[model samples]
Target: MASHVVDDTALAGFRTGLAGDAITPGDAAYDEARTLFNAMIDRRPAVIAQCETARDVAEAIRFGRENGLEIAVRGGGHGVAGTALNDGGLVIDLRRMRAATVDPRARTVRVGGGATMSRLDRATEPYGLATTGGRVSTTGVGGFVLGGGAGWLDRKFGPACDNLLSVELVTADGDTVRASEDENPELFWALHGGGGNFGVATSFTLRLHPLPVVTAALLLWPPDMGLDVVRAYRDFLEAAPDEVGGGVIYMTAPPEEFVPEDMVGKLACGVLVTYAGEMQEMRDVAEPVLGLDPDAEMATECSYADLQCMFDDPPGYRNYWSAEYLGSFPDPAVERFCARAADLIVPSPSQHVLFPQGGAVARGPAEYPIPWRRAPWVVHPFGLWEDPADDDRGRRWAREARADVEPWSMGAVYLNFIGREGEDRLVAGFGPDNHRRLAEVKARYDPENVFHLNHNIAPARGRAG
Candidate 1:
């Protein structure tokens, strides 16, 4: 069926019914509104509904469906797949809905769907409370939690969805619903790793934990030492406490004050050790790596909120990212991982990272669909570069990295860290059993499969309209 063009009268009606702006092409803000994190995605949505409330979202979806326009949901626009925007369709942009209401006494925080990690982190920081958030401050809370969130605090508090208390959503039928343990329990379970297939999450209420201070220790060495450092780091993490978290990253050395002049802007390896407690305890925990004779090191105690944004990726770059969960990272696997770093595009903002998992993450609720949590390690190649000509090279680097570690892969992976691979990979993100269960939930709430943008799970044949 061919998509029908939205007429002026229908567009006018949608514009009139919204409490926010309905941006169209030729509008002054259209270009700025359509831009996402990856500059490679140049899509032109027929209309950009900058929704401010849940009702605005409902109106946008209804308008899109009635006009035969594909619907795209834009949260913080951090997804590498560019699923948040579509070509010549309707975009339900939620960037205007940022709000964080903290219930400090109850140890819960309700965040708007469009709210970013910074919004939620800053809101709870003053109360000395925090939750697991994405590595960067700009990631959307809805996408992160709904898609199995992971971050520096994950090893301590578990993935972000583990802290999920409730979700307020606007379904495909334009009905407002709430999913929680006590309400719509099945839908709530599906929301654990279901992505945006069921509905548009207008807000999410998450459980928070007490976190007064966080210590971050960054130790850097030349690229040649990566193999030894990775081996020692793996040994240290195997016996490390739950409060100890962070990753081993291989990237171009930054030209910061602490970095030696010779190593600046050159290929290098670094280990970031994040401790959930005070600074002194972190130093004690990170001593194993520090003793390796790092050429440069910076360790400091800072608020968790501030640390969240420490490595935020700069926008306006072409990006291609992929991941493989490993059952084990033995010496040979470490060698392959480090050797692949040579293929990385240096003099750019790419990172070949190895993250350890096995604390609250591995011990998190087994019922949730995030099967990758059991894996002891993850190899993530996040490729970001400025030149458009580097697009093929960047994508090949990420693909080759996944192939390099394929032998050790556990067959389960995190969907949030990757782009569109295929349907099989989607099922791999959630095991086949969970896929069937979530498909039934998709049948119940969004039978039409109207929201099929992010890691979509199609409704069962009989259930789909």
Candidate 2:
């Protein structure tokens, strides 16, 4: 349990063998390297290995284990739990490995562990192809996909993990491995939603779909209309086709050119719909919601890549987020969901969101550890605000949102949508049976739980102890 005091000799040796720089606390860019998307997390690792290749990742893991340093693997550093960092430890920083290679002919993309959604999207845009990705462009592909990614395209293409073809990983023993349906099959199954628990994913090869253009519609109204709007949106999504996606959100309206002046910076209720089709087809599919007479509306066809960046949530804010999956969103659930919106910190960048999940997301491989996929609705309380003074209020609001939906809750949750809740929630992320299977896989790949910083799955006792 003692901490490792990395000596000059060991540090120098690690630096000599790395293809990229090994940054230390004294380094000029150390602060920037340690910075995460959430302003609330602040940890100082003894060494940060900015890996540039799979080999680099392996070497970094070896160095960390040999030096007795607690290892933290960091990609885009967007995880709200701050597991991407560890105090007085070693960090395998993959931010420099941001290459995304697209094979247009094969309809696949090989993205580096550190590559963000922006990199992945832009790489495939020219090919008129895309896969399920995080809603924010800045999210790291490694964390998002491994954690079971959800996005605007999820209803059509399914969760990101469903599209994942393979992963190149570096295990706890500093060995390079490949996981796929055909190779290391059990490990591949675990990687579906087991997250960074097994090892550091050096790169991911994911299946992409042809999506030249996507139609997006944003219809907004005052906060007072939340109840009626939420109910209508729920009813509409119940029968919506797989091609339809998006969510109902309550947030402070931004001062975009399309937003009315009165709505900007005020609490507003809105529905964003994305369709994997032409504008006319989307208009026809969305006619029911369109008839609601929104105070402000913006509907158009845009590049899938461009549309991915439309709702980029700005970082550098204090963040606390939580999610609850629901088997159904009845009228009472809708009322409770809308009522919780009142607790959200208005005039801030927080969002009270309800995402529909019954399309391809629900239809994805049922065998994967992600039990939350079977749910039809997901209530996501994304709390982001500038003032630290509102931290308590933000946390309470997110908790209340989940509590209000407990009556209709499915118990299973999406790990990526939440911060560190506790062991029960972690176990619930994967159902009991899936968790046991994932733990066995963890036993094989990372018995010592070296990659324990994520939504961790402790290895089976016989293997680890």
Candidate 3:
């Protein structure tokens, strides 16, 4: 069936006064206008309003309501589920609102919702500083923080949401409000890991941290060493200091300058490790795993910003992501992880990843909106395919792999890893109590549930009038 298109003639009177670009379906720039980071998701909204200011967002909300159109708010469009796009809806694009104000002495940064990781990292790196951010430099800070971002320094620091000091958001009713622990405390709590249920966040006042000089690198192990590698990793992480962070992925090794071409496309285990502390302590920490195989190369010191980008696969790749938290990595689960990975590799560049948890993630869980505070690790099946024909194949491999780990799971999923298939995962992301509170906040600020585009949280059904 052909999709509905809201006529440009209908919006003609509305577009002229706004400070941002509004593209309609037939516009020449419409194709690029609707593009996002993930290639697997393809949807075109009826109108794309590339908003440059909070006022533009408010105007977009007003327009969508008056026109009876659904709304999708795009920050960095790095969401695994492509929540940034919509079919037959209106998109409020905040990409142009990229300004950032860093207060280094105060150890804080007030960043626009549209700011990218590269933008944030570059702005703070000069002072040897950083905030919790995604591994990819391209990830939008807004979406990353809102969904409880875990990055290279997450073990040393906490999740991004934990560092957030305040947020400026535009409500579903075209009203702007500032949320923080001391101010709108309820809304602030909900904003921490609440997804986009409450509103379109315009900016964030996030706490920053000092970056320690560190050794970080990808330790590649042959496919035959998967068991030895997973075992060594689990053991090393147990005694590792908070300054150390790592995640292991079963992947097809790349034929890069650092990787031997003879091993190109060879199925192997790649451990992305980052150690932030004194160089001597870093060497001692890595010695055990480096001793496992003489082929395990020693890591080199790199800046925190560079280290974060080291493992993030490039954007525009066709991919599917499914994840669950693990209370512990038992012997059987390790065997299952490696065994199932061998069978689930769909095509080129797919990775079965196991990210270390605990450390700062488990600290002060009572202060954040995230659930699954006790989980010690996260297991994600990242299905990547270069062939469009292999879409279904890639999806099935990810699903079957997830099934393999279901029994070992901690019954919680990361909000960022969720997409359209995760509508129910939203409730699972936050616990029933937090979800209920978020729904109440939704009812108070947006009684009609105007922001329904995200992993939707329907209003508390509202109070009895």
* TM-scores, one per candidate: 0.99, 0.98, 0.95
Query: Model 1 shows how many backbone clashes?
Result: 0
* Index of the highest-lDDT prediction: 1
lDDT by residue (256-312, candidate 3, tens digit) is: 667776666778787877787665677788776766762345477877777666666
Q: Give the candidate order by descending lDDT.
A: 1, 2, 3
- Evaluate model 3: give its TM-score: 0.95
- List the pairs of residues colliding in candidate 2: none
lDDT of each: 0.93, 0.92, 0.81
- Record all residue pairs in model 1 with backbone atoms less than 3 Å apart, i.e. clashing: none
Give the Cα-based TM-score of candidate 2 against the true structure.
0.98
Q: Which tens-of-lDDT digit does each residue in 1-465 have in candidate 2?
A: 445789899899999999998999989999999999999998889999999988889999999989899999999999999999989999999998989999999999999999999999999999999999998888999999999898999999999999999999999998899999999999999989889998999999999999999999999999889888888888888889999999999988888888999889898999999999899999998888888989999998998888888888887999999999998889899889888888889788899999999889888899999999999999999999999899899999999999999999989999999998999999999999999999888888888888998898999889652
Backbone collisions counted per model = 0, 0, 0
Itemize residue pairs with steric clashes in candidate 3: none
lDDT of 3 at 174: 88
Q: How does candidate 1 score on lDDT?
A: 0.93
